[model samples]
Target: MKIRFPMRASVAACALCAATTLAPASPVAALGPTGGGPGAIVRPEATVPQPAVLYGEGTQVRLRSGAHAVPDVTALSWVVADAASGEVLAAHDAHRRLPPASTLKTLFALTALPAFPGGIRHTVSAKELLGIGEGSSLVGVVEGHTYQVADLWRGVFLNSGNDAVHVLAALNGGWEHTARQMEDKARSLGALDTTVVSPDGYDADGQDSSAYDLAVFGRAGLRDPDFARYCSTARAAFPGTEGTFQIANTNRLLTGADGVAPYPGLIGIKNGYTTNAGNTLVAAAHRSGRTLVVTVMHPQAGGHAVYEEARALLDWGFAAAGHVDPVGSLDALRPVPRGATTGAKPKTAVVASTGAPRPAEPDWTQTGTIAGAAGLGAGVLLLGLRFRYKRASRA
Candidate 1:
């Protein structure tokens, strides 16, 4: 009798074997004990252990030991924050305002995610595609194409498709209304210094924000795994009239030798560039269970330099905060009592009360008693004077 296992089980076994084969070789395995290869048994690198809680919402990472150094870049402003602790590790004029370029898409994603559901279908119109003008890059979304909401999102994020953004905005509302919504959302997220003049981050006067605000917005965007996956993709395909249109991610860090390597634990946020903004980058790197967010805006050179700087900062943060967990029980820390300083005089207490109550009627009863006493004193004085006058006449 022939016995067979389920097809799913067979497929799963094959997938497991493939995964094991694809695992990276370890350093020790690559360099054998005696520097000979025939007897060497190779082993995969140990996976970096992640913290139980990688990132706490709104909490920044604390730096404990590593050198805190800012990278050399023309970035008008920048910030490196711990994604877990919400602690700002390093910064350079982080609040200084600058044009965000495509980085503003983070806000767009934040606003659009809640409005559109996954797998929702939307029809692209000719009017929506028209008058987008020209830009650094586009996903080339054709007019009159009906696409799913998920595909449109991939176009907006993976490809920074300006046309895709316009279509999304038009579907939600017109550009003006969409822009207002973006601004409102930014404000609600505590990005008070940010102002979005355009739905897409095209070169428009007064469409600007600070590096600190961008870091905050980047963290919020990363909270959504869908957005994170889209941002991290190096390339994506969308159905077109002729065939599937393939678009390369504008972010160079996702691909090539210049790109950020897939270390133990790595997740994507976003990267942007413009003449005014230079090569700006928002990178989130996770290692040894800690996640760090590095934002460099307007770096002097290209994206590669910004990536290198960001990587260095991440390494430093990991080393610094490796052992200490300052925020573990942050609630227990409180302000010290006043006058508790050594050699300081103890504070004196003074009794105090609210002002004296006003008299209801100026004390009318007291006025009568005062008036009677005055009249009696005057009568006594007059009698004494009369007696003195009578004595003077007799003498």
Candidate 2:
């Protein structure tokens, strides 16, 4: 069963153009919060670390007496958190802003998904395909082909299709409008680090997100029944000019493609890579009725380091759940209540936090058994079935 939402159309007129031609790649100067020297980033109040400790440059974790050490990785930034409670198990530079690459699609889906339902079909117009970046990934969307909204989302999730994103963005109003909506949505979700210059998440100047914000996007996306279905879809037949073609999910952990073994109880979220944002990933899995979300960004080591590090973090997260206390929170910040005439500093809601002191150097060798939230799968399936029945009855 699949579910979709109603989309508002705000089509802009433009002469039909040719399908996007791949152009020669030029080096993109890294230019965002990350390009600034260290300490250059001035975070929004919403993006500030909930617990003071999350501000540290090194790994942050508070383990109980018996808890094993967290797996060490070379990720520039990463976060592991419970999807249900919003408890951050551990993180390193979680709020340090950096390029997000295609993983920013999670935020895109969060913003635009509900407006375009699965059953609604749109005919692809050449105008809608304009402005895709040179050297961008595509899922082979062709002009004049009519496709279900669901099909386009499959292309987005499985192929990281920037073309599909542009078409959908056009439908949502236009590329710029969709980008604005994504930015607004990010702020609403307390993802203050994100700056959306391209709705498709093609690298643009000043566009970046932190591991904390990406995990926040992933956790929030999984809560939506439609989003859960789309992200979790492993493979599907995509509508094409010739006919339907098969597209498999690019998330290595979910599909076990490219020698990365399929993670047990793994559920899809998103993955991304570019010359700048090397191998960013956001993954969630369910085990023993608990759901865990992990985000890894720009590991220093090249070649599958992102996925391996994410997997290792997941292992440590599940194993450390009961043993380690939450160091911070993924909860969005809210206005702190203030008295009209009081001269006192304002404070946001008190987030759950507890942890032991960090070791001088993490013991990466500590091994532990672990595992995802099972309830969400059941809920998503039931919601999809009910929505499918309703749509069928209407048909």
Candidate 3:
């Protein structure tokens, strides 16, 4: 159903998907199959970071067989981990941070999801729209449109819209404040590799994240049912002033929009790209009883290189599940206070990251007071998938 952007006498809708993506301008160390394209970041095998879990004999044999051939894109980095146990199964340049493109939205969502409630409705403002960067992707939000908190999230996970994120950030507080909260949240999740300058992940001067951290985001986000639902929705009618339009997910693995088939048992997570970040993806899948998350970054652009690499890793992870031993853990959500809960259903264990500011706005559940009634409604807050040689994703 459409979130219902009323076609009343109000502001008109303009080109929504006109936003642009960021391009990597700097050079860094490279790690690729053919040693990567020219000037690609390369790190020696000895110096490259390793995952927490060491591969077992079965996994080692799988790698040696080379029959599946790990994703061959150069400067490509990835990690595979168990969703339940926090065990890292395999990794390649897992900690080397690079431009994250839209994948950074995962952290943004984590930091902001709790502030607004699903039924909460908010109207767009010109000042809020001003912050969205040109050339960034959007879901066609008109300036005068009134939308539900749920509608904005659909724009985010489904279309990877810069507009949707901006609206949420504005409703929470100010752009700068929301961003500061996100950065602090990253360190608490142990995703220290991330540096978020732009919330929508449009390559800023120094925005970066690691495949390892992405896995952490995916695993952590999935713990929430709301996050899981948004990622799993393949297509939905995004709200608009005149009418709603069907917006499909940017994640091709889940949609099977490209040559790839809908991965069996595939869920949702996220996928992103920028000239700088190349094509990046974070996916979750379940074959049997085990759920695995895979994050791949900076694979060759224009082809399904990122997804293929992630799938190969998934292949190994599932086979290595019981066979391989974990080298480390994906840090648990900061523990909750002894008596204070995070409003999470089933009571998931998560704590606010140190130094992060809690939004002061009132939510639908908290009170009838609406966000944006007062400067972004103070004190309010709340808050991919690709591939496989033959695999799936979770959003």
Query: Best by TM-score, which number?
Result: 2
Top-down lDDT ranking = 2, 3, 1
TM-score of each predicted structure versus truth: 0.63, 0.72, 0.68
Enumerate residue pairs that collide in model 1: 50-289, 59-85, 59-86, 60-85, 60-86, 60-87, 61-85, 64-320, 65-320, 66-320
Full-model lDDT for every candidate: 0.65, 0.79, 0.70
**Candidates arranged by TM-score, highest first:** 2, 3, 1
> Whole-model lDDT, candidate 3?
0.70
The per-prediction tally of clashing pairs is 10, 14, 44
Candidate 3: where are CA atoms >4 Å away?
Answer: 1-75, 332-395
Residue-wise C-alpha lDDT for candidate 2, range 1-395, written one tens digit per residue: 75543321111111111111112222223223655675454443332235667767888987889999989899999999987777788999988999999999999999999998889989999999999999999999999989899889989999999999999999999988988999898887777889889877788899999999999899888877788888888898987767788899999899989998999988889999887788899999877767889999999997789889988999888888689878887763422233223232222112122222111232223211100123344445556656766877799
* Model 1 vs. true fold: TM: 0.63
Candidate 1 per-residue lDDT, tens place, 1-395, comes to 64544545555555565455444444346644544556666565422212212223332334446534334555556666666545565566666788888888888888877788868887788998876846556777787777888888888877777888888888887888888998887776667667888767777888788777788777666666677777777677887888787776655555544545643344666777666667677777666656677777776755377666667666665666644333221101112333333332222111011112111223445556755665565556556656765766697
List RMSD in Å for every model shown. Answer: 30.3, 26.5, 27.2
